[model samples]
Target: MKILAFSDLHRDKDAAWSLRDAARAADVVIGAGDFGTRGEGLADTFDILRDITVPVLVVAGNHDNLAEMQAANRGWPHLHVLHGSGVAIGDTAFFGLGYEIPATNEASWNQRLSEAEAEELLAACPDKAVLVTHSPPYGVADLQRNGRHEGSRAIRAAIERHQPQLVLCGHIHHAWGTKGAIGHSEVHNLGPAAHWFEI
Candidate 1:
């Protein structure tokens, strides 16, 4: 299947329009998250992406409210807002885990999970499934501007164990569009621009 993936839109209408056009040729469209600005205007992003006819999968970024996004798209059959869950499209199994591992960040919209919490949430992921997350795995497309690798160790462990076919993530703006690997899995730190892959 052809997958079109993007992340960290942050309510950019231009990016959304571009993604809409890109989605036409894709079997699936995946958004890694950060559609809103500090948990606001998320509905606007959804409105812009409403033209996509294919299956739309999204995870909540640290800047977004998972509950709000889920509630907003509750009635939309084509859109799936996933968090620590799995969904099947055709024969491919996709799993999602959103937000960052909890830290003493000052941002009020920053949603997080502890290392153990993340591992527990990811334990249900099926082997070789496509993994989607808002934060990248440790040391893999997760470098920060401060020259530090700010990623979840639990997430890395999960990827190592499950060996997903592909891992999609965002949040490290400086590492956007970068690619890495964990065992047999291809990991990408997607940006607002659409990325196409055949899986």
Candidate 2:
């Protein structure tokens, strides 16, 4: 399968437009999140991306409002706003967990989930399903500008237990475009750029 993934667009129209063009060639598109800042204007980015006819998977980031994001593309047949849910396309299964896992002090509007909450949500993920999350798993692709690892231990445990083929995530801007690993799973901290993968 051909997968095109990007994250942290943060309402960049040019980036969204570029991804629209790139999506033409992808069988599936993944938007890891933070389409807008502070829960505002996320619909603007989703508007451009919704044009793609392929299966487009999205998750809410710390800066996003899931209800707003879902409302934006309410009945779009190709768009799937996944949070604590899973979807299957062809033979591949995908499970997604949105928000800042382990919590954050960024802003009042920050969407967050405690480690236990995340664990409960992630426990339902099927083995080998593609794991899509807003925050990277602890100790992998999650280093901050201050050299701190601001990731979720629950996410890490999920990777260790399920070993998803690919784990896609974003949120830590400084770690964007970086890569890491957990067991056999590949993890990418994608930024607002077209990242292509074949599985």
Candidate 3:
């Protein structure tokens, strides 16, 4: 399958259009997260993204609320908004988890999950499924400007246990386009552009 994955659009209409146009050649499109800015501006990007006809999988970022996103995308059949959930397309399964894991002190509008909370949410993921998360697993594709690894330990533990086929995430801007590995899974930090992956 051909998958186009991206993240952190942050309400950039041009980027949304870019992804929409890029979806023409992809079988599936994955939006890792950050479609909004501090819980606002989601509609700006969604308006353009709504044009893509492919099966689009998305998760809410720290700047977004899951309920708000689901409500906004209620009528869209092609767009699958996921959080702590799993979906199957063809023969592959995709599991998604969103927001900043292990919590964050950056802003009050930021939605976060503690390590234990993340573990509980991630427990339902099927083994070897494609893992899509807003935060990268601890120490993998999660390096920051300060050289700190801000990923969730629970996420790492889950990766170790599940050994998924691929891990997709975006949050730490410095780690964009970078790839790492946990066990045998390929983890990528997708930025605000189209990344092609074949599975």
TM-scores for every candidate against the unseen true structure: 0.97, 0.97, 0.97
Q: Using lDDT as the measure, name the better of candidate 2 and candidate 3.
A: 2
Local accuracy of candidate 2 as per-residue lDDT tens digits, 1-199: 9999999999999999999999999999999989989888887788888899999999999889999878766667898888999999999999999999988766888999999999999999999999999999999999999999998999999999999999999999999999999999999999999999999
- Model 2 reaches what TM-score against the true structure? 0.97
Give candidate 1 misplaced runs (Cα > 4 Å): 102-104
Candidate 2 contains a number of clashing pairs equal to 0
Model 3, span 34-57: residue lDDT tens: 999998888888888888888899
- In model 1, state the lDDT of residue 174: 96
How badly does each model clash, as a count of residue pairs? 0, 0, 0
lDDT of 1 by residue, 92-187 (tens): 999998887645376777787888888999999999999999999999999988989998898999999999999999988999999999899999
Candidate 2 residue pairs in backbone clash = none
Misplaced by over 4 Å in model 3 are none
Predicted structure 3, TM vs. truth: 0.97
